[model samples]
Target: MKIEVNITKEPTKEPISFEIVDMSKKKYSEVKIYIPKKKGRKSVAPGDKWYVYFYWRDPETGKMNIKCKYYRGINQKKTVAEREEVAKAYQRSYQMLLEQGWNPLKNKIKNQRSSPKKQKHTLKSAIEYALAIKIRNTKESTARDYKFRSQFFLDWADVNFKSGLPLEQFKLEDFYQFMDYLELDYINKASGERLSNTSIDNTRRVISALFTELKNKRLIDTNFVKGIPKLKSEPLKNRPFTHSQLIEIKKYLEEHDPYLIQFISFLLYPILRPIEITRLKVRDLNTEDWILGVETKTEAFSYRKIITKMQPIIGQMELKGYPGSYSLFTNENKPSIWLPKQEKSKVNHFTNRFKKVKKALGYGKEYGLYSFRHTAIGDLYNSKQAEGIPEQQIIYDLMPITRHKSEAGLRNYLRNIKIALPADHSDIYTIDF
Candidate 1:
């Protein structure tokens, strides 16, 4: 038995048209039956009828056995086009199968419908995904910190977990043990010292955030990181640079390194963190507005200080790097290592340089890199008072410059910094009214 399906198309000048012809040699005309209309579907194309007929040979009788035979028109359906396509495909296969002397229907048929692929809910993939999300949302230095912590989580899971199974199986006990391991057992490989309570707390915090993100995604039953408390640590003592010390440092840097002058000057006028200073790009400076922008760490602007005269300094800086092209600090190929490879590397590359320069000029280590900012703020506060400006107004003026998030923190900056105001004689002339 053999069957052939011939397809012809209309000419390009004519409307879309297809003609299918069943040029089949074998026909089970006796067993052929009409395929019925599918219920609740649109009627098939006008006057189009369908028929099916199948047969296989039996070994014992040496006779052909009929499997199924159908012939009919189906009602119109949204998929009438798809139905027509399947029919054409069946017709195309008929002659090919006959030539091969095999019938698929005579044996076990292959299922054409496929099942959907599943997503992995395993712990390792989820942590990596969450870490990626973390890195995207934060700055480069912050991303590095997250990556370091993520390694700890992975190493612990590899050793302690059962092939590091899915998050759904992660329990509260697992969270507790991991946190305890960081606090009590873990040691810094480079420093050869135990982690501080504060560091342990921060590690716990990042891990907790990891679980929280997974929980929100419905990947876990709960965050599994609760009841952990932050460590209570003492704030380090920070002091300001004095007027004479500032004069000395400037005079030395002007003769020694001209680039250091502009860089250090930006830190003083803007009163920004060292990291924030290093992250500044050429585009962040606006000479027209006399404002320098702090884009990441803070959203405030630093108006060029009147006493230091920052606008001229910024103009000179623009000439060094193409505007909107590179960092304010360097036009070199790569960014400066503001976030040094390790925290201690900062001691040699950053603090020691400042420390060495200052100490050579007869200043102690007490006048640190941040002292420049503290000194500027202290001077601004004192200068305003010396100019007879009110206390509340001075605080209001410097709050944004210092980028203190709250009033209490601002008060802490003002404490222990003495500013002598001239005796107020205006009150003596006022009546008791």
Candidate 2:
């Protein structure tokens, strides 16, 4: 293992390069000098640190791992020639150590070898194992979501590959094939419809998570899922319900499923997400201060004022009568006992109910439970604009109501939802043509 180091001055501005020559007649992988980049400068500055970087191939795994020998003392030299001499000296010392079988990762490699062998995994087993770990760490709703997305890849693998395919055998190319399957052939067993690009991308994320877990557990060498590029997904914006549609829905819910009206009120007035509303308990409401403690997506909880619209709705409900621990919105659409298992179904209960109402009204997929929130926010913005309220004041007022952190965020949300359109623009722009 007698290795030689040779320095070469390329006609470049920043670097004095070097290479490792193996006297045993073998070439070392990726041997070079690494110079730190300087802003607004093409050449290496007077005090910039650099290093000799190379790769060391592992005997067991045959993996080329990175190794570096830094040359900070080179910077202490005042002149270019002096610095080059010091760098060469350091490089030679490093080359000698390499010839003597010195390895930066020697201790790491020994520890890895001494450690217990990782359990082997098949494609099916690896996915299941990863899912188990994921399910254990995440919340029930999140765990369910992970599992739901994972099933798509699991089903695809079962059909396409041998049942006993080893985890290592599933390469980057195979993952791309699975992605193609998702894009072209896969259909939802429940909906009997092809998944949108966004849905497919979501599935990609879940699969990526699983592969990452497997890699961490040492079930496989590489996470092929990470190599797959993310597909660009067109954002799916839910349209706000028109005034006539809102009136129709309100009238219909009042007669058919009045309980749902209470649930929708939470979405409409407080502008709560369906999931957030489901997580709310009776104790969260403060009638004295007219403040509603909301379960937010990011934080443990947040507060929103009980607006004039929601005041009557809360008064109608016998929330105080129930135990404070009881969920605010139950299957019965009132504050009542909610079992642990029932927590998962709370959002779906309202969503399905809303779907039924939409179906009866001859509504399409564009209208959803979220549409109520968008509709309410959009209408509020339009109403305030009509009243000649300053736009900044209107946005500031809506901030606490919508729970947006910044004016820019709220503005972007309004823009993304296509709200606050100027009324009768055609009439204003009309000319005698």
Candidate 3:
């Protein structure tokens, strides 16, 4: 296809219009024009002029097409050299498009109508997407934690979580501001302490993940936190009951609240989490084997594990006035009672009751509800070690009962157990070993 160029001037026109025709001897005589928008009632305006380029290719053979770019100028006059330069630039672009077998006249019109639209990406939008992805894969408790912490991010940054901003738009300054907001402004309602570094770090990690998703989708150019450092946390202090303290609590529960006796046995004897114990039904117990079937938080299927100390307690419960069908612990008489199902609230109540027992026995504030779990695990670790069991083997045995997901998780649990153990044998060591 041959190229054609034209220059023309006409007077007495309302708004000047320029047209270019592909004068090649072809089947269809394709044409393109430049018509500028009029400005207010003015006959001519400098901004009213523009260059409109076009191309036309044969539809049958799928070959090269004739192309043209008409340099349309309105009130602003152009010199011969300027017009020639504009024509030459258009010719170059036309030739490039022709080489790619693009019909400028047809493609340019289509492109003008169907050009790719830009979406408004915000920080809020990214968070929503990230949260949706998390909800699909994570447990309810995990999803709740993410949702709870996400509010801090939204309130601090003053961004909506649903309308995610582009990742590229985030600056280092924004991160520093967020951290400052968490440290200075964000306060825990329960403890009134400034948000902990660990908590803040978790929020940061979520934000980082959001940006990662955006980058993966090619929605953003870069992750803003590429060089940012994670917040550090101090080692947690060990807090667990001494063997004598455990015995004292058990005796108090046996005398005062028979229901609590079974609960304590579930904790110290079988090494069951309070939630796992509460979730247990009468049918979950194996009287013959003295095993308690516990449904773990992570898994759907229950696990049956023996609790030697619990055998006597279970027999005692059977001997007591409680019915066989009743829960080991209940607020009301017999089979069923609707108590608070929230684990944290139940734990808090247990802790308060434990405090009363501790005060009665003259034990200090150091003993808490969690002490029972710590003491049980510590006792097991010591007993296994004394029996010539390797640390790894002990960990492996405890992993299923503890419901730890990874070897690292089990190792951390063991580390805590060791920390909770007494320095002197006579101070807090269990007699079971």
Which of the numbered candidates is closest to the native, going by highest lDDT? 2
User: Which of the two candidates, 2 or 3, achieves a greater TM-score against the reference?
Assistant: 2
For 288-402, candidate 3 gives per-residue lDDT tens digits of 7766666666666566666565677677656344344555454552335434533345456556676788788887655565667777777777777777677778878877766
Q: Candidate 1 vs candidate 3: which has greater TM-score?
A: 3
TM-score for every candidate vs. truth? Answer: 0.54, 0.62, 0.57
- Candidate that beats the other on lDDT, 1 or 2, i.e. the better one: 2
Candidates' lDDT values, in order?
0.58, 0.73, 0.58
Model 1, 1-433: lDDT tens digits are 3435444566888776554433343322223323446575534545655544566544345456646542322222213433443343344334333443434455332221011012344576667655644543344456557767877788888888632686567777777788778778888789888876767777888878877776655566567674577776433334676677778888887787666677677667767677666657666766655566665454434443323467667666545446564555542423332333333343234455676687678766446777777777777777887778887777787777677887677877567443333436776786666
Model 1 / residue 286 / CA error / Å: 3.0
Give candidate 1's TM-score.
0.54
Superior by TM-score: candidate 1 or candidate 2: 2
Clashes of each: 14, 0, 15
**Ranked by TM-score, top first:** 2, 3, 1
* lDDT value, candidate 3, whole model: 0.58
